[model samples]
Target: MFTTNPFDDDKLREECGIFGVSRAETASAIVALGLHALQHRGQEAAGITSWDGHDFHTHRAMGHVAGNFDRDEVIRGLPGDTACGHVRYSTTGETSLRNVQPLYAELNSGGFAIAHNGNISNAMKLRRELIRRGSIFQSTSDTEVIIHLVATSSYRTLLDKFIDALKQIEGAYSLIVMTPEGMIACRDPLGIRPLVMGKLGDATIFASETVAFDVVGADYVRTVEPGELVIVTNEGDIRSHRPFGETHARPCIFEHVYFSRPDSIIDNSSVYSVRKAIGAQLAIENPVDADYVIPVPDSGVPAAIGYAQQSGIPFELGIIRSHYIGRTFIQPGDKVRHLGVKLKHNANRALIEGKRIVLIDDSIVRGTTSLKIVQMMRESGAAEVHMRIASPPTKHSCFYGVDTPERTKLLAHKLDIGGMQDFIHADSLAFISIDGLYKALGETKRADIRPQYCDACFTGDYPTTLTDQDDVVVQNQLELLAERVV
Candidate 1:
């Protein structure tokens, strides 16, 4: 029986979401609403840890934000002007409350709390080292490693301690740290994930997506640049710093294809528009002789619209997603995982029956789900499932934040296009070219400032490495990622 993980679950795994509030009177309440916007990223566990002048208070539960923190008392319990919240889908540790984030630690230097997005590649090695040095762990999450590092650092300054700790660990991270004085937001150098900063009248907010700022009525400031840090004080003084190994600002390309909301902007580009352009490019590159175009649904809808417009084929909603189904149950078994898929999506026979359909999706990971999806389309009487991926093949795993399959499990790594076509039982299959992907991102001008695309999953140039004994890999593909930022 296959275990359901955020990275390998039958249904899509929500990305991790983070929210940090500085100088807000109702920080906890604002965090709750922001978490709601980012709920799309993670659904397994929710937590908020706030630091008042005196101490830090934490409220965490193992469910959606709505269920875990729906009550007034829960939010009310976490009182503070500076706060940080996390919604997690456990890419590193088991899905238990013990691993849920916004990890609060009372250090000898002072009291502080941290909420982190993305995964650390060197967690296992670091954890073992910490254990040898008398660091006891309260949780299995790689996030806790930061706490240990911070506690053990010899640096006198808090920021220096933070920087020292960050230097030791490697991988994708957009961290929101809360202290009695202020809040600090930091993003990794390679920029494999998205993190943005915003502000209201007298408050500052940091989130994984721009939509969270809109939800909390905060004015969008800008994205926290790769390898940059923003520190906000209770007096409303915001300081920004960048201490990183030199690397290109290659934010995850998949963000535009799937992870980001269509409305959210990453690296100052509209996600929805970029995805549409990808579809349009796909149509130009691989014009299939099909009657109609069908989106995989939800993520695929916008791009499919672009594909339909560019391909001159009628866009059809050939698949429907069921929003009511619960993701997990008391039982942790294949039956539950299978039931989860059934609850999540189904084919629309009326729309797809006997149709010469062109399928548009963001990308294909393992051959299992895509293969199953192809079978569902065939069962719905799709005459020819001509699959066109919006992005190129994900042939490598992400050492950053995403839960991609290992290099070996990736179908693209194992099979050629023809092999994949046969494996998925599709009549025709074509993926967007790397050039086409850059064009979709609107790289028309010769602007060196915009950063290069990290097609690691497509090109096998990972930002970080997994040479250490840790199950997780560091954020930046040391050699490649280091050069990009430098």
Candidate 2:
């Protein structure tokens, strides 16, 4: 079931986004444009694989799609009616060239290309079993593990092999595969990641978000049902199949809260409108007497507007984001990553000087970014910074797809509200109540089909238990870190 809590504060992390096209013309260019719309989900790497029913051509690079496939020669190089693309953000494996997806494998039957959005919780077990059968791995990613399993399967047909492979694996996965025959898209039985279909005249496209379909002037059809597989052929035939019976349809609610664009819709709900309602609910639940309601730029913009409208407080863009700030410069180093947020955002001193500020932010994952923002606001002469989070406190880690680690890595799990106020240097800290959050999104009923959210990170309600010793080791490491901090 989906976990809905207002006080559950956690920074929502995005996994990845996918786009695939099946048309006779320049499918590579169409995929490039579709990937551009879905780029908000990932930034680490971009890749596209095209097949012309005869041969497969692939292009991959470690940057935004614009720079990675910037040249016409690169796009023109891959000619095929059917193409699959991926924009990746590493939540599990090390961020490197080898990890860039659209992981392709060649077998005696033919070559198949695959791009996946979510993670498998039991990947270690699956990889171990495959290795026992003598399968060599080029990348440390769990996604590659799936391809290997399917390739070595006894099933003669690719679709049968795919079904057989999924039966052995457990956890969240929204996959798109390219075969010699056609294009295949499948979502996990739980549907933790978002995948939707669209139609533009005579063409059919599948993407991680509805925004991608909108870019190509395609009309939204519907979300790929949980435990369902969709196939699109070269002749423009679309087929849907549900092999798995009634399982939990636990779509990631965080997608509506943070990962997806406000303009996009997921699971038949408008993400932007739902987020605005969350802010409105926050204002009503925790009304603050402040001069102005300021948002933490970008992510907080929509919610801030709703909060201001609900509380009768003036809305102001107190923080401005600089688009020119390249995402690549924020390396893994502590000092470098810490300064990245500062370079990306700056406080509007002229508007905030000596004002009582009610700062709205989506979530505080590590608290580093929020701490920096609050300190910057104080330096800009803000009298007091009251932090209001739009979602609940994240107390656990998400193993499904998101990069959230063990409970020890979560600030809310380690510190109380008061301690968090001190750590962030905010005069006050109040998060939206979980009930109120669900009410705003109209997901108050626990038994509703689409109401169950993947609150594993916020509530520790992990859907699947980890059995691998290595997973336990990672969890223990986080526990040790938390103990030392306490």
Candidate 3:
């Protein structure tokens, strides 16, 4: 007997998703729908917290949103006019319900609830300092550090305290906070993570993606600007502030590449169109002679279409995916594991056999999946398998919010282009140039002085300070010195 595991992939994972609404009669229910739409961002756990004027209510569970928030009883129990929700895939904390978001606390001001999407790069250092100052933490999540910071701030107003807390933190964050006073939403200074504002009737909405707004039947408003904060009062008065001051905004480029849904818009560009552009650019940069262009399915479909159109080659669905399998499943044994790509994907033998094919994929991380996929093509009687990747090689790990392997483990870091081609057993392999990637984004080329987006995984040009990682390096050096002394 064989079983499939969907988590066996070579791609990066997003940190989390956040959705919030203010002054709505069915706030919790609306938030549930929004979170459901954004579920692809996180699948480990889901939570929602709402304020019903006088009291706060919460419901959290470990699993998909449909398993927990889909029940009518669950929604009815959480009665509130203002609500915020989170779906989490842990990046900086353990996989436990205690680390789930929509974390709540009662301060001198009133009840407070918050949901966050992004990693705090300096959380470990901040956690150490806060513990030294007698702060007690309820969860191991980095988001909890923000709660403690707000609780101890001397600022009289809740908004000021929240701003004060944000000032002390570093790295990416898009926060949706709910208090008895109202709902507050803000994006980090560099906009490393995404947050958008929308409107449903008189109700104000905030979510990690525009797709969530569509799910709730809300009118799409603009993205919450970098370093900008908006507070929706209990009485429904909206106020905007720029507490963090202006800086060069370098939003994560991966959102367009993989993180966001095709329908959603980020930084005023359509994600679907941007992906197609990337494929077109890839075709121009790495033109290949093949009988047909075949997408890997799902994520690769749009790019493959663009590649075919640009290269004047026929596009075909040469691979099919099984949607029935869940994100993860327990493998029965090694026999099943060796089945490899067949568990989730199967080659269209009639279409692939005796054909020279150009296989298009969004990106390659470890090359394990690519190797298996190429081997499957050969088994299906394909004459030649040319792998065409839409993005530049991923040589560095992401430190902001994406879950990526270390540099030593990255396939690109370990192998050059020729080595990768041999490792994957592909007839030939090519990736989009870094400058070509920028061209797809409407720029002539990437600016060496100040690149428009954060391509840290591709270019290794991190936009923010990496304080915690530096501290770790220093600590490891001291430990090694002590061992030598002994």
Candidate 4:
């Protein structure tokens, strides 16, 4: 299927979004509303699981949440007072109905359902061991590993078994789990992924972003602290545990750059404010003169405004984006298919004609989108199109729940700034420095101390070891060595 946003093809995709609420009326409806607020996080599939005290009911669909969960019949079918839902883009698992979550299973303790929003770096290593030990598998999703681990743990209680499962995994995650006993929401030790707690009347809510809470008219309480597991029981008792102990937190830096909605709040900072700060930082670091400071469109708006303010350049709508387009269209021919890009974004030729405009974008991944956008600007009679990226160059693949291209496929990995400028055919191009990015986040330069955020895509300073990826590398080398010997 084709993407609705043509310019989004080269962007890094956030793997998933999760939401859960307990002690709420029509819990599945609340989950659906929350998931709609988080649609940007993932769009490939959506699911909601609700426990109606006696049994768990779920509806999983392979598309946007609107078409699947917006129907009354669908929400009514999931009868319960507590529910959790997920939107998935398949960073690790295959894209199929089987891989959609909240994945449910009947354990010895009772019914259990889980919705996950992150990647498990050691999943493949653990999966092999679980299979070797006779655990029957289901989906290929790394999240299923958590279920198997919990099922096989020798602990007496379900809570202990869940904690035991957490200890065996690595990498980033923020999960919402539902069982007969309670609803559990927790983050990985480093808190590489974000999860926030909110309140709606008597109900307790948990979501990947505060925006979800806002959508359902819930008040944001605070972030679920790093390494903390918060449980809201069937009896309405709320408890917290710091099972992983204290550890330095390293949340994904790109959330501020791209993943989150501008209206969301993360770590007490407004996402919109942070993005604007990033643009201001970009302007301070790379001053440019142009007729108009134009944003690439919605995502780039805040940054463009910040840049325009900082540089004293007038911001203009050089490109207009259409929000009404569907996810895909049947491509009958090459010419028609190429026009799909214009259906999403078209040049405002009247404003852009004979103007030297600076296009501000969040980030450049493979540079394919940037190239198309720049070419569009030129075709609109723009005298010169300068490009300013809000974030630092992405040079490494993300293993923490983001769908990223391989290292070699990343344009930043393959090319220097000058090369990228030429490749995108921009009159000039500049990206925020790594130091500038930290400064925007209200921190000192990266060189001055250990990094506070997971900027591994730019700096390659991974917060956790990637066992599965390393195993693949080692296997590839072993095969190469055998080939040489033969």
Candidate 5:
């Protein structure tokens, strides 16, 4: 039996989702709803920690939010006026209940609960140093390193220590921390990860996406600015601080392409609109003669519409995806596994047969899915298959929050456009240029000096130092050498 999760391997996995609320009557319940809205970001584990003034209550489970937090008893177990929750897909830690977020630690000051949304690039180095200093760790998660840093900080106040811990960390983060004093929310200095603040009457809300606020009847306030911290007290007093000083914002461009929901807005731009713009740009760059423009389904829908509109090609649902299936299905044997893409998606044979089709998609990662998808279309008798990608080729692996395979595994990193076209068995393949991608974002072109967004996966201009990955490479090499010697 094939027990592996097939649906997740082809796409760039999202980092995590975080939701928190202060001064709500049923804060844990509200958090559960909010996490449900942001569930696409993660599916491995879910956790919530709430403060009932006198004590902190926590419940964490190694599964989806609906399975773990949908029950009344689960929500009732976490009674408090303030609560924070996390839905995690691990990038820097093993997938285990112990690695789940809303990671609570009782400090000398009081109980501290934290939920994180991004990767700490220097976490391994920090973990090694902290371990050498005799700091006992409860979890192998990189998010735990932040708590250790806060615990060892020389700062007097809890807030100061939290900020002190953040200052020492590198890479992306959108953190929601609940304390005995209040609830705190902050984003990284570069704004690489997204966090938004909102309000529901007297309740103050913080979530990874605006869609979460929409789910709980909360009005969107504003995005938590890069390097800015906002604290909401038990009495509903709000305070904002800028601790990281000034820095250029480089929000992840991939969020618009795949991670964020189409309904959500980030930095005053509609994600749906941005994706449409990307598709329009792709159409302008790579026009092709086709009978119909078809999306890969779901993620590619918006872009496919845009491409069709721009190219004067009729858009049709040439492929249908099954919604009832979970992310994975246990294949009974090789025969079932060979069914491949048909398990999740099937070509509308009547619509696709004898038609020259233009297929639109957000991004192609490892290319395994693309290969299978193309084969599916061919098997269904597509006369011609022209593949158009809305974003530039993803050549480098992401070291920030987004979970991507290594360079060796990336299709773009190993193959040029011609090579990819042959590999996927498509009649033609074209990806939007990097400059065209910036144009879709309303820029004339990408800035050569400092990019307006983190397109590192496309451009290889990483914004932060990748210290952990460097150490990992060295360790792997040493292990290989030792094996050879033995």
Candidate 6:
């Protein structure tokens, strides 16, 4: 039981990344390229489904997109001018090939393929009701719940049925659906996840991030507006529909902090610029004197640069990360396995020795990696290690597609600022204030104005009703009562 990157275990992970292209000869290839750019979002499995007019072709595998989808044979088999794909990191379902996307099914309307990027908060409750109504399930994925909803919909037209299903569901979803009619892309009312539209020649493309379009030489058109659905007909007619009433958009704020690529443009602002702004705001709020500013590596780089520039402290690579680790490698014994952190990251002792340092990271979830990284800095002879987190302390769990640890397990939920500082063994630890985070996003405090993005993980102000979670609580109480009777 060797594994993927052990260092990533402490961070929040997005559940899926999706890409689709309509009316293009190179649809599958372009989608594969887009998924490659979004590989950071999900690494467990990859899938692609393409419709060749009369029939649908699909290829799915349990691994990264490069090895599975980059092959010519795989792309050749999926011959279609309309296609969509998904890369998954399972949160609501079992991790198996059966649960991979784009989850396709033959329906009365014709072949349907869907790639989903967010969770359905009421999926469990809906699943129970659907099951009782005799809708046999093929996979345990929440995404399949939508398929069943569409199948059972009594609305006359396929589009009408799809809209009816969307109205019944709650919580976040950015979906790219392919059908015999054409391709459809949409976002949830609150837009708790991200989805973007793009163009390459006359072809229409949809992806989880704008960076995806950049990869395949496509021009970004715009973000698919929250609660809005855009449909592209096989005959190439495109139309927009707003089934849900106008609602305040609440795109995930963490996208600017960690989930999205630095080069991505989110909400008309550069993600790199926003992270740097977050770092600058953090520096203003929690200034500390140190010899050099160090990033945790990769995702933390942009913010670190911002903190450094604002604080007038030189930025240096105090930690070096190795990117070539395999998904599963030979772990000889406990002693060797215990050195797991060293496999992916190492303390740059030469730069760290005898120096006081400031370490910048995107966020501290469980604080396990933070504690380990601080320990590494100490062992490398650093006099002091001050940890600065770019986002507000994540005290709540996210049910909207992110794989967040339970609230009880979150380090911020269990400990106050001082307690967490002590737990991680850093000289000091400070996360950006909630108000400061909004400032970085060019907004006032949430109390002064409507929230522009979903900061529920930090503030616990979830915008939607969590029916499945409530169901779980009721079920737990009933089970306890039954035990007492027994």
For 10-69, candidate 6 gives per-residue lDDT tens digits of 889866899999999968998899999999899889999999899999999988998899
Candidate 3 local lDDT, 224-259, one digit each (tens): 999999989989899999997877788998898888
How well is each residue in 42-107 modelled by candidate 2, as lDDT tens digits? Answer: 877889999977999999888789977768999998898888899987876888878887988897
lDDT of 5 by residue, 79-164 (tens): 99899999988888888889999999999899999999999999999999999999999998889999999999999999999989
Identify the superior model by TM-score, candidate 2 or candidate 3.
3
Candidate 4 deviant stretches above 4 angstroms = 1-7, 447-449
lDDT of 1 by residue, 1-486 (tens): 212332235233556999988888878989999999998888778899987778889998887898777788887898878788998887888878888888888888778788888888888889999999999999999999999999999999888999999889887888999887688999888777789988877888899999998898999989888899898887889898888856577777778888877888887778888889989999999898888888877888888999999989999888888765454544446656553444566888888888899988888877777787888889889888999998888787776667665678888889999999999999999998887888888875223344476667777666666545244334445656889889
Greater lDDT among 3 and 6 belongs to: 6
Local lDDT at 210 for model 6: 92
User: What TM-score, computed on C-alpha atoms, does each candidate reach?
Assistant: 0.90, 0.92, 0.97, 0.98, 0.97, 0.97
lDDT scores in order:
0.82, 0.83, 0.91, 0.92, 0.92, 0.91
Candidate 1 vs. true structure, TM-score: 0.90
Model 1: residue 221 alpha-carbon error in angstroms: 0.6
Distance from true position, residue 374, model 6, in Å? 0.5
The Cα RMSD of model 2 versus the native structure comes to 5.5
The Cα RMSD in angstroms, rounded to one decimal, for candidate 5 relative to the true structure is: 1.9
Q: What is the lDDT of residue 221 in candidate 5?
A: 97
Model 4 pairs in collision = none
